[model samples]
Target chain A: MFIKLAALTMLPVALVGGVVANSSVMIVEVDADDVHIIVPVPLSLAQVAVAFAPDEAKYIQMDSEVGEYLPYLARFVDELRAIPADAMLVEVIDGSDHVRVFKEDDVMRVQVDEGHGTKVNVRIPLASLAAMVDAYDEEENMFRASRLVGALRAAPSGDLVHVIDGDEEVHIRMW
Target chain B: MNRKLLSLAIGAAMLLAVGATAQAQDAGWIHIRVMEDEGTSVNVNLPMSLISVAMELAQKHAFDGDMDFGDEFDGHVRFGGRHDVEIDDLRRMWAELRDAGDADYVQVQGDDETVNIYRREDTVFIEVDEDGDDKVRLQVPFSVVDVLLEGEDNELNLVGALTEMANTNNGEILQVNDGDTTVRIWIDANPQG
Candidate 1:
C-alpha cells in the first residue's frame, strides 16, 4: 500500500542545463521514495582540497597539481562518510564508493562502493518528505523543496519550471 | 568753520553710505523651486546665510559617512529653515571640509529616480537618472563653484549661475521628464515661501 502511494506521489526532476548532462559533474535526484547523488571523485576531491588553501595565490598554485593534496582530500571525504544516515533527512550511502540505499518499512539500507565515481543513493518515505516540505513558510523567496512542492500543487498539468542564470535558461517540465 | 571743509566731509560720508548699500545687494538670498512628477511643486526661500549653516552642519556630521539622511536633508533644504544661520560661521565650517577632503557630494534616491551632486576638483557635477532610462548630467565650472562655496558674500546671481551651467553643459534643468515622473530644479531671484 505504501509503495503504491509512493509511486503516486513521486516527484521527478530532470536537469535541463547542458552543464548538468555534459560538463558539470554533480547530480542529485530526489523523489518521494528515494534520493540519489553522484559526483566525479577526483574533480570533486581536488575542489575540496583547494578550498582549504591559505590564500588566493596559494589556491592558484595548488590548482595545477591537485593530486598532491590527496591526504587532505581523503580526510574530508571520511568526515562526510561518518555522518549517520538515520540522523539526516535523507540517508547517505557508502563513504568512498558508489553509495546505495533502500527504504524497507521505517528503516533505510545504505551501501558504499569504492569506484571512480562517488554515488549516494538513499530511500526516504513519502510522509517524511511531506513533513519536511511543510516546515517551510510560503512567503520565503529562497528555492527549496517546499517551494517546488507548492509550485507543483498549484500548477496545472504540463507546467514548466524555469531556472534562469544571466541570459541562459534551463526549463524543467512536470506532468 | 570753513564752508569748503564742511562740504567735503558731507561728500565723504555720502560715498561711504552708497558703498554699504551696494555691499548689501551683493549678499543676496537664494530661491529654489522643486517640481515633482506628481504635479506637486515645493518652493523654498533660503537666505544665503541658511545655505552656509546647512553646509556647515553637513560637514560637522561628516555627511559622507554611512548615514542615510537623504530624505531628512532633502526635506530641510526643500522647505525653509526655522532659525537664522550666521554666514561667517558657515564659511569657516565649509573651509574646514574643503581642506580635509578633495570633494563633497549628495545623492538622493526616490522610488524610481536618483539625483547626485558631486563637488570635486573645484567643479560640481550633478547627475539625475530616473527609472534607469532618462539621465541628465551637468558640470559646474570653478567660477560658479566659487560663488556657491562662498555664499552670501559674492555678487553672483544664484539662479543665473545655475541656469548658465546647465545651458553650457547641454543639460536640462529638469532631471527626470518622463510620463511617469518629472523632477525639476529651478533657482529664482525672488524669494517665495
Candidate 2:
C-alpha cells in the first residue's frame, strides 16, 4: 500500500529536491477543499518495496536508438551541472502572470505566480538531476534502480514542488 | 688553397646537417597544446622513441591495455559506441581505401553543421565545422591507424599504434576550436614541442 502511494507520488518529484546526504525521507503534503493529507515516505525503504512489484511494472523500456545518444546525453548533463548560480534560463510574462525559470545556488528553480494565492514552485538540485540522468543504462535500455535511489539520496533537503490554487495546495519536500 | 679547403668543409657540414634532419623526420615527437579563453592552458610533448620503447616493454610484459581505438574508418564508423564498425570490418575497409588511393571518403553537410572526411597522400583527414564557433580538424596517418588494428580479433593494439606513431614523420594530427577554447596536437622532432 505504501509502495503504491510512494510510486504514485514519485514521478513528479523524482527529478527534484534534496537535503543533507544523510537525509532520506520525503514528505508529501496536499490540501484540497475539505481534505488534508500528509505522508512522510522513507526513500530507502520505499525503493525496496518497489522491487517486489510485478515484473511488467518494474522498469520503463527505452528506445533502442537511444543507445547511440547516451554518451552525448551524459556529456550534455555534465554541462548542465556547471551552469552558474543565479543564471536565468527562461522567463515569460503576460499581464499579472509571470513564469520564471532560473538557477539559484545549487538548485534550478521554476516559479509561476499568477496573482492572489495561486502560485507554483519547483526546486531541483542540479547534482541530483545529473544523477538521475546517470541512472540510464544503455545495454538494458532502462534506468538502474540503484542510481535512481542515489539521485534522491544525493539531494539536500528542500521543497521539490509547491502549488497553491485558491483553496487547494500540494507540496512535496525531501529531507 | 685555404679558401678551397674552407669551401669543401662548408659543403660537407651542410650535407651532414641535411642527413641529420632526414633522420629526425623518420622518428618524431608528438605535442599537444590546449588554450582556453578562461586563461587556463596546457602544453605537452611526448617523445616517440620513448613511447616506442615503453610499448615494446609493455608488449613483452603482455600488456594489451584494451583501448578500443575506435577501430577507425574508411567506410562507416559510428565511433565510441557499441554499434561502431568491428575490427575486422575496419581493416577490410582500410585495405580497400588504401589501394583506391587518395579520395574523399565521406562528406556530410547540414544547415548548422558540416563534416569533411577524406584521404590525401598517406594521411586520412576528418574535419568538422559546426555553428557557434565550434570546429575540429584531425588527420591520422594511414600507417598509424593500420597498426592500431593489427591486434587479434575484437581487440585494438595500442602498442603497435605507438610504434607506428614513433615511425611517422612530423605533422599536425588534430586540432579543435570551440568557442573561446582551442586545442592543437602535432608531431615534430622537438621534445620541447
Candidate 3:
C-alpha cells in the first residue's frame, strides 16, 4: 500500500515533467613540463611521441616522413629491438636494424626493420582528434600552439603539475 | 497572498545559496574575459635565436609599473609548435628582444647620434635622430613571437608587441610536412567590432 501511494505521488511529478538532470564539466590546467609530448587534439600520447620527438629519440625519429638521425641514431635502433614486440605500441625489430614510422591523415603505419618482416600498422580516425591541435617541427626548436594541444611540454626544470578531473580529481607530476 | 510570495522568494534565495556553496566544493574554474583592447598590429617572422637573446635583456632592465597586488594575472600563453612561455619567462623574452633588435635598428655614436632602421612585417623603416627623442619614428609590419599574457602587469601585452616586432620576417617560421598541425595564433586584441 505504501509502495502504491509513493508510485502515485511520483506519477504526477513525472507526468508534470518535474525531473531535472544536470551534467557537470571540470576544467583542468595541466602543467606543460610533465607532458612528454603535445599533439593536436586527435593524437594520443603514443602518437605525440611518435610525431614530435627529435628525429633521434631514445627509440623514435623526429621526422614524420623522412627519418634522420641527429645524435644517437644507432643506439636508438638497438634499444627498439630490445623491447618485446607485443609489449610495445610499435613493433620491435631484431635489435639490429632500424625502423621508420609514418602517418597519413588518420592512419599511422610503421615499417618495421625497414619493411623486412611483418610491418606493424595502426590507424587513428581523424574524427577522434576533434580538431588538430599543434605540431612541433624539430628543425626549429620553437613551439607553435592552438586550442588543441597548447604547449609541447612545460619546462621540466620548473615545478609544475598536471591537473586531472574524473572520478577522483588529482594533480599528476609528469616529470 | 503577499506572505506566500515572500516565503517563495526566501526559499529561492536559500536554494541559490546552497547551490553556490556546493559549487565552491566542486573542482572547476571560471574562465573570465580579461582583455579586450586594440593597438597597432604588425606581423613579423624573425630569427628565434636573436629574439630569445633580446628578450633576456628586456627582462633585466625593462619598464616597471605599479599594480594592485591582489589582481589576478590571466591570459593564454599561445604556442604554434612546441613553444612555452611563463610569467617569469616574459621578463627573459623582453630582455632578449631588446638586445637583438637594439643593434639591428640603431648604431649609436656615443650618446648624441643614432640610426634607427627596423623592419616591420616585410617592410623596413629607417629614421635618424638623437637618443631617446620623439623625433625617431618608424612604422613597419612584422610577425612577433606569440606570447599572450595579460594581467595587472601588462607585461604580456608590452612583450608581445616587442616580440611581434622583433621576430618579423627573420626566417623563423618553419616548414611542416602537413598543413594540419602547424601553429596558428589568433591574438585576442580586444573583441571584434
**Where is model 2 more than 4 Å wrong at Cα?**
A1-23, A65-73, B1-193
Model 3, position B140, has a per-residue lDDT of 42
For model 1, how does the per-residue alpha-carbon lDDT over A65-92 read when each residue is reduced to its tens digit? 2332333333322322332333221222
What ranking emerges by DockQ with the best candidate at the front? 3, 2, 1
- List model 2 lDDT by residue over A1-175, tens digit each: 9999998898556534432233488889999999999998777666665687665555666787555555544544454454456655455454566677777887878998886678999998877877877888877898767568778877788899999999999999987
**Deviating ranges (above 4 Å) for candidate 3:** A1-101, A104-107, A110-175, B1-75, B78-104, B107-154, B157-193
Root-mean-square deviation per candidate: 27.7, 19.0, 27.4
The better candidate by TM-score, 1 or 2, is 2
Better of 1 and 2 by lDDT: 2
Candidate 2 local lDDT, B106-183, one digit each (tens) = 999999989899999988887877776666666678888887776556655543453455457445444566666666
Where is model 1 chain A poorest over a 10-residue stretch in terms of lDDT?
A86-95
lDDT of 1 at A130: 41
Q: How does model 1 score by TM-score?
A: 0.22
Window of ten residues with lowest summed lDDT in model 3 chain A:
A19-28
The local lDDT score (0 to 100) that residue A16 gets in candidate 1 is 26
Count clashing residue pairs per candidate. Answer: 3, 6, 54
Question: For each candidate, what is the lDDT?
Answer: 0.37, 0.62, 0.31
| DockQ score, prediction 2 | 0.01
Worst 10 residues of 3 chain B by lDDT: B28-37
Query: B-chain TM-score, every candidate?
Result: 0.34, 0.56, 0.20
Query: Per-residue error at B39 for model 1, in Å?
Result: 19
